[model samples]
Target: MTPLTLQTPEEHPFAQFVRILGKGKRGARALTREEAREAMGMLLDGRVEDTQLGAFLMLLRHKEESPEELAGFTEALRERLRAPALAVDIDWPSYAGKKRHLPWFLLAAKCLAASGLKVFMHGGGAHTAGRLYTEQLLGPLGIPLCRDWAQAEHALANGGLAFMPLGDWAPALQRMIDLRNTLGLRSPIHSLARILNPLGARLGLQSIFHPGYQAVHREASQLLGDTAIVIKGDGGEIEANPDSPCHLYGTAAGLNWDEEWPALAAQRHVKPATLEPEQLLEVWRGEAEDSYGEKAVLATLALALRGLGRAREAAFAEAAALWQGRDRAAL
Candidate 1:
């Protein structure tokens, strides 16, 4: 008979998940979907210790994340989101601020709104420098940034377009996103935030800087049972560069697909000038002649239109027409 040993009850419930990922190279392994969900659930519940939280995140960062992990984490996160009582046609996330160009995608979203498509856009910035954020541009451009779900509903009902900051919609995750500065590295939250889709919109448009993330986003969206378009948009914002082939990954009605849209321009233009919110307004008004900018806007809109179920030819034609026929005075 052996003396009974108390096997130090498994560390903290959350620590078990951390140890699963941080175990040595040969011993460590990616968390299963359920494990990932439980880990994120613990983090969101504020039960994870701070020290463990950092170590867990860094361990994940070191190994990167699998699509299964993203799906689990995202599923856990969406559980905490509070959506407005309204219909949204597109779930547009704008996390990466524009650094190389003005946010041409904003104009595209406005174009969609002008065409009666309700666009629910959400994002965060300030973790990076010298970039123009959608929240900052929307206000001065006269578009409203919603302070809460009720305000988002009002904006959608009356204006057809609404913007929500991450901090307002999901403060817990926003707190994690904000940690980018302190950690000196982006955690998996960066990728997870783009797919939040809080409103349960039918279509989600996501952008990632890294090309590999394209597949990760596609798989995660499929797991969430939502349709989404993931692109390596210009400067990691949702705006596409018409001068380069745009790689697209998405699922529609349960069918997953990938395609490459040919570039619209022969030559890539140099960065025009310091991006200005007023410039966005000017282009929208048709008072500015930016061939590159206009093509970028229309091309980006075409992707959105296509994602929303318009035929390829029809989407492209409709996108160009909408850009040309937009209500310039609305902004």
Candidate 2:
């Protein structure tokens, strides 16, 4: 073998993005909108080394992303998404699995679907334990789960509702989402996924556990030119809790606003013993009397209908009327 000459390798194109955030306090700062867009693009393109990727993600988590950074990162991911064949009326993202209660939001989506709104719901599960995931409840509820864009379209055509797991739409982001188990902390991927809205739906629904992320999502949605509603949902999973007050943020026709909804159930609330999927169906079919669960379903549906452009003045009454008239046979 011939003697080999040693050569200095050029730095990775993605290193500077990490360094920009990790530099000393005097020099380090959040990325501009453009830098964030560029960084996310490089990341999704698989140009960053594993070490650099981890560093960048951790830095973002520690700093909590700015509105600009969120907007840029979301825009980058949105650009890479394979567009669906058809438009959905609502983009419901359920990344935060329910820890304290069952996913009441699943029923909310089904309710919307039954009412003729094509709801496209997406999420991932098993990142954390002792939580109920949206995907797990889809089958029993008779809602179809779409594994790819084609199936998503099929499901929509069949039932007017489709649940797409994040891994199916954005495997790269799913890989990042899985890092939670290794990093022992939540990353910005969680926030970015909620705002993805890959299908460019007319209305987007999101929920956040941390109160501060409400405005981050609101501002980012405005940047994406999406009409959305972000709420402090029950267990942070996009379902209104009849037992507690609800805080909401949203954008309508490009105008941003916030609203406060009082609790529908004022008495003490207790979770069910089984937390089974059947309970959701039971409530929807009018076979079980869960006053709280029913109230939560209607209230959540009302918020969603208003977000989808019903007159705000009559949305709640219309929602209650709709709920009262739902075809039990659909269950």
Candidate 3:
């Protein structure tokens, strides 16, 4: 005689996260900070199954991620980053490529770097079509694209600026971003990447094209004890549109606030029919004049200056001076 025993299969480690999000309308709820950290840890470590990954990402996209979720996810990412300590002044995340205008913010960052501020800028590859990404223009703009942290450190120490592709430091996130076409929609990773601040910079500059995410970023930065500025920037990038009033949502020193910046132009300027990357150089080299582009650069620079504790008027003044004093032959 033998005793019959039955074995039960264990649940997948990642299944719990998916179930939490897709538990039907009433049963579904957001993951708490600890749960979010664990789930994101699995995702970053490639421990999540493909099916689970797809479902989790889509669910977050559908429900939209909460500030707590974003903060938790950022905590997971920061823990996994393979970067050495660097004295970076600004953490500028450039995920959204420009559609309507050249990235005037690129010029702003370069101007700041030339003024001796260490800027760490990172962005994903061109996952979407018809958009000019920052990486694409780095060559023409004479900015160094660091392929590794050593190169990044070198660039920062030598030139005061470094633009690293997302894949270089955070390959898992880059893979998730690459799923845009497969998923047919953006996932929460797009939002999370903006606030990674892997270098632990004093100030972070973020931009979102979609409405309502500004508050998410502001609150998440507050939770992470990060100083950040979020804006509905031009073409979803962090370049302010000089032709329209811009709203800024930010968090610093345990406080959250908002401000409205009036349009620099009295009237709206028509967008260029085509985007020429060389125009960035032209504007920088003092070889050509673009009224719209120049103002956009100044406005974006002012936003960064403001984040660094300058008064509104003082920020704009400092931005103008930085732009004016930039080496014409630098680019």
Residue 172 of model 1, lDDT score:
78
* Cα misplacement distance, residue 69 of candidate 1 (Å): 1.0
By descending TM-score, how would the candidates be arranged?
3, 1, 2
Local accuracy by lDDT, each model = 0.86, 0.84, 0.93
Residue 199's lDDT in candidate 3: 96
Q: How many backbone clashes does candidate 2 have?
A: 0
Scored against the true structure, residue 295 in model 3 reaches a CA lDDT of 99
lDDT of 1 by residue, 1-331 (tens): 9999887656777878888998898999999988888899889989988898889888998998888898899888877666645789999998888788888888888888878989999887667888878877877666778989999998888878999888887887888888888899988888888887888888999998896988888988898789999999998888889989998898977789988899999988888767767777787887878878899998999999989988778989999899889888877
Steric clashes per prediction:
0, 0, 0
TM of each candidate vs. truth: 0.95, 0.94, 0.97
1-331 in candidate 3: lDDT tens per residue?
Answer: 8999999999998999999999999999999989999999999999988999999999999999999999999999999988899999999999999989899899999999999999999999898999999989888787899999999999999999999999999999999999999999998899899999999999999998899989988999999999999999998888999999999998899999889999999999888999998888888889999999999999999999999999899999999999999999877
Backbone clashes in model 2, listed as residue pairs = none
Residue 84 in candidate 3, Cα distance off native in Å: 0.6
Alpha-carbon shift of residue 175 in model 3 (angstroms): 0.7
Clashing pairs in 3: none
Off by over 4 Å in 3: 1-7
